[model samples]
Target: MFTGIIQAVGRVAAIERRGGDARLHIAGLPLADGKLGESIAVSGVCLTAVAFTPDGFVADVSAETLACTTLGDWTVGQAVNLERALAVGDRLGGHIVSGHVDGAGEVLSRRPDGRSERFTLRAPPALARYIAAKGSITVDGVSLTVNTVSGAEFGVNIVPHTLAHTSLDGLRAGGRVNLEVDLLARYLERLLLRADGGGVNLDLLAENGFLKQ
Candidate 1:
C-alpha cells in the first residue's frame, strides 16, 4: 500500500516494447533502498520493480495498464509522480492509496485561486458516483481533497507546495490522469451489496451503534 504522497518527480527515460507489453525505464528517483520485486507507485499505478538502474528502476507495464492509464501515451522526458510504498510505522501523511488506477480522468480546467491552483477534472462515468464533496481522491498518485462535485466533474485545490513538488503542475486541459477513488468508499459500496436481499442500512447502523439511538 501507499499513502498517495509523492516523494519525487521522476522522468521517463525510455520505453521498450516487448510484443504487447512494455518495459519502462524511469530516472531521477533514488532506488538504492528498493529491492527487485518491491512495489512502487508510479503515477497512481502500483508497479513492481523488476530491475534497478543507477538512478531509478525498470518495471514492465502490461497491456491492460497501458490501455487503462496514460502510461501508454507517455513520451521520453515526461515527468511522473513517484512514491515508495508505505513502511510499517511511517506517518500516514496522505490517505491510503492502493496505487491501483481505477480509471482515467480528464483535466477539464485549471485556474489560479490565490496562491493555489484549482483544477476541475472529469472522472469516468462509472467512477463518478464514488466521488463526493470534501472526500479524498487520488489523481496521478497525489491524494487531494474534493472541493466540489457535479456529476462526473470534481474540483480540487492544489497548493503551491504540491504544485512545485509533483508533476501535477504540468497538467493542462484535455490531459488525462490516472485516478483512484477513496479506498473506504469502494469497500463501503461492496459492503452494501446484499447477497440475501438485506445488507448494511440505516437500521443496521443504528442497531450496531453506528448511529444515534
Candidate 2:
C-alpha cells in the first residue's frame, strides 16, 4: 500500500526489453535495498523489484503491466514518480492508494492557474462513476482531489508544489497516466451491490441526506 504522495522524482536510466518482460534500471533517487521481494509504487503501479542498488533499483514489467500502464512508454532520461511501500509509522499525508491501477487515463487538457494548474483527464466510463467532485483520486502516483467531473472527464487543481514534487509537471495533452480510483469507492460499490438483492438497504445510512451532497 502507498499513500500516493510522491517522495522523489526519479529518472529512468535504462530499460531492457526481454521476451514479454522489461527490466528497468532507474536512477536519480536514493533507494534502499529490499529483501529479494518487495513492492514499490512506480508512477502509481505497484511493481516488485527482483534486485536493488544504492543509486536505484530494478523492476520487471510484465506484458500485462506494459499493456495497462505507461511504463512501456518510459525511456532513458524520463522522469518517474516514486513512492515506497507504506510502513507502519508513516503519516497518511495523501489519501489511501493501493498502487493497483484501475485503468489507463489520458490528459484531455490543461489550463494555467498562476503558480498552479488545472488538468482535465478523461477516464473510462466505468471508472467515471467512482469519481465525484472533490473526491480523491491518485494520478500518476500523486494523490489529488477532483475539482469537478463531467462525463468521462474530471478536473483537478494542481498546485506548484505538486508540479515541483511529482512527475505530473511534465504531463502533456494526450499523454497516458496511471489512475487508481479511490480504494474506498470500490468497497462502497461492493456494499451497494450486496444491498441490491437485499434484506435492508443500509445505504439509507447515506440515503435520506445523511451523506452530504
Candidate 3:
C-alpha cells in the first residue's frame, strides 16, 4: 500500500528490453537508502527492487506493465516520481493507493493557476465511473484530488511543490498519464454487482464486517 506522497524524484537512465520484459535502470535517485528487496512505486506502479547501486536501482518491467502505463513513453533523462512502499507505522499522507494502474488517461489541458498548476485529464471510459468530485485519483503515480469531474474529464490541483518534487512538472497538454483508481472503491462496487440477489438486500457492511469491529 502507498499514500501517493512522493518521496524522491528519479530519472530514467536506461531501458533495456530483454524479450518481453524490460530492465529499467533509473538514475538521479537516492537508492543508497533503498533496501535491495523493497517495493517501490515507480510512477504509480509497484515494482520490486532487484538490484541496488550507487545512483539508483533496477526493476523489471513486464510486458503487461509497459502496455498498461506511460512507462513505455519513458526515455533517458525523463523524470519520474519515486516513493517507497508504506511501512506499518508510516503516516497516511495522501490516501490508500495500491499502485495498480487500472487504465491510462490523456492530458487534455495544463496551465498555470495562480501559483499552482491545474491539469485536466481525459480518462478511459471504464475508469471514469470511479472518479468523483473531490475524490482521489492517481495520475502518473502522483496522488491528487479531483476538483471536478465530467464526461471523461476531471481537473486536479497541483501545487508548485508537487511540480518541483515530482515528474508531473514535465507533463504538457496532450501528454498521457498513468491512472490507478481507488482500491477500496473497487471492492465496494464489486459488492454492489452482486447485490441483485432477486431484490434481496444483504447487509453489505455486515457481510464484509466493515462496520465498527
Clashing pairs in 1: none
TM-score quality measure for candidate 3: 0.90
RMSD of each: 1.9, 3.8, 3.4
Best first by lDDT, ranked: 1, 2, 3
Candidate 3 residue-wise lDDT, 1-213, digit = tens: 889999888888888989987989877666667777788888898888999868889999999999988888788887888888999999998999998889889999988899999999999999888999988989877889999999889999899888898889888888988899888788777767754553324465566777654
Ranking by TM-score: 1, 3, 2
**Tens-place lDDT digits, model 1, residues 68-152:** 9888899999899999999999999999999889999999999999999999999999999999999999999999999999999
Candidate 1 residue-wise lDDT at 1: 98
TM-score of each: 0.94, 0.89, 0.90
* Cα RMSD for predicted model 1: 1.9
lDDT per residue, candidate 2, 1-213, as tens digits? Answer: 999899899988889999988988877656654666787888898988777778778888899988888888888998889988999998999999998898899999998977789999999888999999989999999999999999989999899989989989888899999999999999887775644466335466557566665
- The ten-residue window of minimal lDDT in model 2 covers 193-202
CA lDDT of 61 in candidate 2?
85
**What pairs collide in candidate 3?**
none
The ten-residue window of minimal lDDT in model 1 covers 192-201
TM-score, cand. 1: 0.94
